[model samples]
Target: MISEAYSPQTRNTKTVKLQADLVVVGGGLSGVCAAITAARSGLKVVLIQDRPVLGGNASSEVRLWSLGATSHMGNNNRWSREGGLINEILLDNLKRNKEGNPLLFDTVLLEKVYEENNITLLLNTAVYEVEKGKDDLVKNVTAFCSQNSTTYIASAPLFCDASGDGIVAFMAGASFRMGAETKEEFDEGFAPNIEDYGNLLGHSLYFYTKDVGKPISYTPPSFAIKNAEELPRIKNFQLGDHGCKLWWVEHGGRLDTVHQSEDIKFELWKVVYGIWDYVKNSGKFPEAANLTLEWVGTIPGKRESRRFEGDFMLTQKDIVEQRDYYDAVSFGGWAMDLHPADGIYSEHNSCTQWHGKGVYSIPYRCYYSKNIENLFLAGRIISASHVAFGSSRVMLTCAHGAQAVGQAAVLCKEEGLLPKDIASKEHIAKLQLALNRNGQSIPRIALNDTDDLVAKANVEASSSLKFKGFSEADDWHPLKFGLAQMLPLKANETYSFEIEVDASEATSLELQLKSCSTPNHFTPDVVIDKKEVDLQKGKQKITFTTTKTQEQDHYSFFCLMKNEKVKVRLSDERITGLMTVENKINKAVSNYGRQDPPADINVDSFEFWTPERRPKGKNIALQMAKALPIFEPDNIKNGEVRPNANGNTNAWVAEIEDKKPTLHLKWDDKVNIKSIKLFFDCDYDHALETTLMGHPEDVIPFVVDNYTVKDASGKLLKEVKGNYQAINTIELDEAISTDALVFEFSKKERHIPVSLFKISAYN
Candidate 1:
């Protein structure tokens, strides 16, 4: 076929006009979350991405692991993983790709967005221009797609700029900052000196390697750094280390990370290839002979660029002090981590981090532009000082905050309001309640949902867990470092704990009872009592009694100080609200048992009592004086869905022996229930890092994999199998009028009990 048109001046690509209730201008984790949440909340949405796939930094291109409050279980954020759509995504990834393949994670994000009918996903579309309406409102966004050579004009009432560089906000003339703030500007003592530390963090590139079963050869290009073996960070490179493990291989801090990304990529490639050459040619790594480059990132993972301004800028003080916000919408626990400006080339440490005693709340005021009326800020571009961005810039934290922005967009459309209006006193609670209803956990805010019919019904389970404590010893955990058993205790209650211990020699063991200054926090800063017990050489029982209770309910730490000769018994029984943490060092993140920075740094000095990963982190076996009745059937009607800081399980857990556990709900009058929402326990303490981390199990052991719902006559209403997600919503073909409902569950694992957080029925 011959084409016959050499017509006029120039050919114009096709231009498409799209409209929706909300327009999301990025396809990163945050933007993907925002688009999905808004669409699920009944908003017509348009999702535009500059890249070929979703999950910006977490995508296959960048290969960064997604993490949030759990912080790799390397900190004191017990059961503090993020919730909502991001939680769903991570759990889904865990179920499908526990091996954490970046490509598989890409399909998960794509499937989630594609399944939502309200979302119009446009990939490889870069938004370059913005149209403004009256009173500084965004009217429409104009983007061009090089893949298809088409222009797209997407118009919506509200817009969210989760683009890492704040492209939309920048083009719309929004207020923003690109570099570090002065110490005097935000009273941040951890602020870096712009000259020595550099004002901005840099970008990072990662590569993966595989064993080819035979010897392989590598020849670097002429552009590669020839003397990579002489680099300052040469010692950090290991033979098998790849991807984010080699996160120190970075560049482009002195230059503009956005405008000079290509320069950074070239430098990173040179360094990466040069490092491979050194591994092959140098005599140090003999084990790398068979290792071949499996994959390498095309684009560098950006750490910082332009952070748009909103009504309030989060500062280091807020994170360090664990400040509460009136309009708290989300939370973050990643240490205030900042990278050296010179990146891998610097002689200084690759990064510096400081952790707060507990997780801190993120306010709604930091979610929308201060001047741009319709612009919603999310991701790393949210309003925050450089000191705060070190913690909030992580992908999961950004996605958690974006879930709030998504719900706020829906509220703005419904109430005929702007983004700023949702943070006010009258509207903030509504927004928070909506977020909680959708599985987003705001630190102290419980969802006081009055519409849930389960709240009005009388609930009774076949059997509820009585906290007599796990006495079945599976192994003996030696006291290499300080170990503590975290138990939720009742106020003014006398409790006695009997622990089995083996001492190598006759020695005195020091025991302490401690609790956090804040009742709901996990930080054991306040000591209630201390005692020293004499022990013999052989195995024996060590008992402690405590009647000194706090003014309110809280988690008590039964701490056994570091004793090299003592070994305590550990139970394999894993419960919903119980755990044991040790005071030790995780050098990977620079945690050295305790943080004692210079007093002038304005950061707290505290020990990091973190939990060990699975197949190892077992609870201490003990016998309680009395059974604690915290896990009652009524907990299913409570608004709280996850384990809270107060140590309340917020769930009804069946006894381990109750094989066919069933819950019965009785109501006075028949109620119309078209849908049912169930919340399950997913072990939030486990950080489901998206890539390069192998999980012990595909489905969290605590989740109820098989369950069935029955109506008054014991007729099956709904059945679920192999469920792994935390939130499950079941919609019936038609509403059923029933005065009673019965729920039967089967235990997935023998050691882990079946538990349900909350249940709701809607007409």
Candidate 2:
């Protein structure tokens, strides 16, 4: 182990023995997420950040926008919820900051970490020395801060090196590597023929400006590139100067970005100001009178430095082949975006790019030090070759990697095991389960027959079913529905069944059954009937049941609609000319008293298993269909309507023939509803202008039904009341329970324009 001998004077200067369950060194995105996750999991967390803010390169110091795992071209998928603290911070920013500037971003991230009860953040602090036990486990870290000018010792059961430079791992005797590896070492497509440890990608200090209105005279800096050939081409310019557009490439002779940050800063400042001067003085921006500088990132955005050594090192080849690891904990999809070893100014060189076929899973073994038992690493510091680092270094992926490491750290703490020891299959399964519960999408797995049968038979099945769509009619077939068919149901007996679909493409499947008897007089009533349930992207399911009936039924079956919508109904009531028994049975069940049934009958339990294919393009038709019902009201009225002697609105009437109606109403914008009520005119039969009331600003009109409405005390409200005949009034008690609400309606001729009267509170 690398040990630094301390003198008596050094020992005497330190008084406090700071301790925690985990110590995260670095306040960057990955480090902050790590600290938050560990802390939230009930671990005592201490986070040390060198700067006052917490977001690292994407922080106010650098001003880089957070990018996710999909296409860098603004089409990639975002990081999943298992990204943990980062996800929370992102969601908060998305809600609070509509402009999405960097200053507000820093405050939000800092506040989130500070608000955590289990976290202690140390700002403006740097770890100067790391002490290790004889067995190579990190013992303690001594950090010094200019704010105090005194060295402080922080000891923790586990340590995470998120410093981007791998400082803690390096000082604690962990093996590591720097710069590009040889092709022979990692077999990477972009690797050099021989190892070039000295030549690495440098860092950048980015800045931006807003082009307001006025023209301001300016001049280009002396160092500004006058010719097209001299300008860096890789950093493409955007419509506005408020982005990562300037490359200012540097080369082999002066490529130390971290060490020569002052020089780089000077050059970057000149470039920024020079661009503005050119736009103003050259008359290129004649109307740009009020061009104002918005933000100048102070810290150097370092891309590469040191990488820690772990039990298994990730390589670029693993990404190309779409390799899967049993211990996989994270996935990276960004291409190998490698900057030239020389600065952006090099004439013969620019940035190098290598795209991946798809996302590749990262194993937990790559996150911990090979020699140090208690030491873990995340972000750009994790064990990976330089080429592999190019792919994994993006902010969102790094955040995900940090979350995995943090969760694993908590697991290790709870189980009293080292990181390496916890890298087994069983432990990985537990970790995967935890991540899944937090909304992370892992790779898919199928279940065996025995597991499938058992899961279906249980009333509360824990598993979900899979359905694959086929283009050819002959290819359509039944899968594992026999168990459901054979299940015994007595006369007047009620049973609930759940159906889950994990198909990547929209699929049509038939639920069929063989012979059985009809319901008797003692059977319960069938109350619910819903047809055409649509499953959108990702995993979706539906549950329904017939009335409580002890009837041995027969020949019950469902035919898949060509459009792939699932139909369900609870009925013993026979339709005209349909099969019926003398002793018909239908039962009624209370909606409030029933529990949610299992996901799917005869399905297997597995993690992250989505069907191989799904319908292509946007499901616009499905979305529209779902939206149509909310706009159509049963009653309506054109003018003033009055209630009858029975307290019912006689003015409200259903005009079945005219096929057109109007609705009018006003609300307090703070209510919820299961359905909308419309007062229409006597001239129309159908309701139009289906105005809905009480909605939150953040709730999108298209996604209204996805969430449940609730009141201040979290009580569920009843459905709204009305029909498509004439103007009618609805009480707040009939609306769904919610603290906030909004109005939604359809544009039709027969609908009456709504007007607000008065809303009263139920004391």
The top-ranked prediction according to lDDT is 1
Q: Per-residue CA lDDT of candidate 2, range 484-552, in tens?
A: 211222334444445444444565443322222221111112212224444554455454444434334
Q: Would you list the clashing residue pairs of candidate 1?
A: none
- Tell me the RMSD of model 1 versus the true structure: 1.5
Residue by residue across 589-705, what tens digits does model 1's lDDT show? 668898888788799887788898898889999888889898999998888887776768788999989999999999999999999999999888899999988799898898899
Best by TM-score: 1
CA lDDT scores, all candidates in order: 0.90, 0.51
Clashes of each: 0, 89
TM-score of 2: 0.59
**Cα lDDT for residue 515, model 1?**
80
Model 1: residue 371 alpha-carbon error in angstroms: 1.0
